[model samples]
Target: MARIVRKPGLRRRGSFRDWLTMLALFAAIAFAAAYLGGSEPLRGRAIVVDGDSLEVNGERIRLEGIDAPEYRQSCTNSGVEIACDKLARDHLRKLIARQDVTCTALGLDKYDRTLAICRAGERNLNEAMVRDGWAVAYGDHQWLEAEARNAKRGMWAYGFEEPSDWRKDHSGEETSRVSAKESVTLHAKRMFASLIAWLKSLI
Candidate 1:
């Protein structure tokens, strides 16, 4: 058999420091892999989509489960002034104006909008809007339910204002004699400040 002589120290096992270095290296590699995987979908050129929304390379992202005021959707209904939705959208836009926004996307939603929790630097856009009465927390389940509930923000402030769903109030005595479409159109013109004097009342 060939002689195999080892130095006394060379034969010794690795110390705690050596183990720690190995462990840290492995941990760092694992962490990097996880981070990169998590960040893949959310990476892209960001475009603003209203207050609580943004586009990741043109994907419509709703700020997580949070619901901002309905904007560019329905402003008027059947000629009854549906002002709350307009108000909510306005407040949200102002809150997130020209901020460096980052978002953690969960995935695509039913509406095809990316469901994400947006952030403006340090502030969470979802929570901020709800906290400031700028938007509703959206859906029954939310991370910051207490903020909207206790603060009575957004739709909570309006006892009569129903969100997204307006059918809940239908089938009762209509607010005015005008049709819903006519009312909505009339209000839209007024909101843009172009409603004529007779046109306003005719609806």
Candidate 2:
């Protein structure tokens, strides 16, 4: 019986293939991290979805720490009716002005939108919106809101309902409503997604 001999190059090729597979796997994980969660920043040209919302790289981001008028909400400026919602949206669009926007994800909102503090160049979009009176400070930027109010800028120059108040009054008309059970389900999904992203970062 002849003794069997294994080629050295064959084992080397097998090892290289395994190494390649691992590299590909890690690359995929990193890509997922960029989108799913982690500290990876989302950067791209942003489309103003609303005053406090943006679409970047196909991702919907709600500007953290601020709230803007609902899309159908209106306000009065100098006793003249104005589309405050459109005004806020237009102002945000002007601020962006086709600039590259970068957003750092904080977490997810009840709407399942990524909550982020975004910037265009050196300007913080959240702060700018509040400071300019296009948005109201929700969890942050109170000083900016005060400044805008004192200056009588944007919505401060007009009479309008608070975004949250408007939402409550128009809840019946608002289409984003989710049932109590659905909200809990979505919240769990968000938590799970966050955990998975975190684990992927470790690899």
Candidate whose lDDT is highest: 2
lDDT of 2 by residue, 79-106 (tens): 8889999999999999988899999877
TM-score between model 2 and native: 0.68
The lDDT of each candidate is 0.54, 0.81
Model 1, 116-183: lDDT tens digits are 66666677767777777655555433645576667776555545343334433443432222322333
- Runs off by more than 4 Å, candidate 2: 1-37, 172-203
Error of 2 at 161 (Å): 0.5
TM-score each candidate: 0.49, 0.68
Top candidate by TM-score? 2
lDDT (0-100) at residue 95 of candidate 1?
60
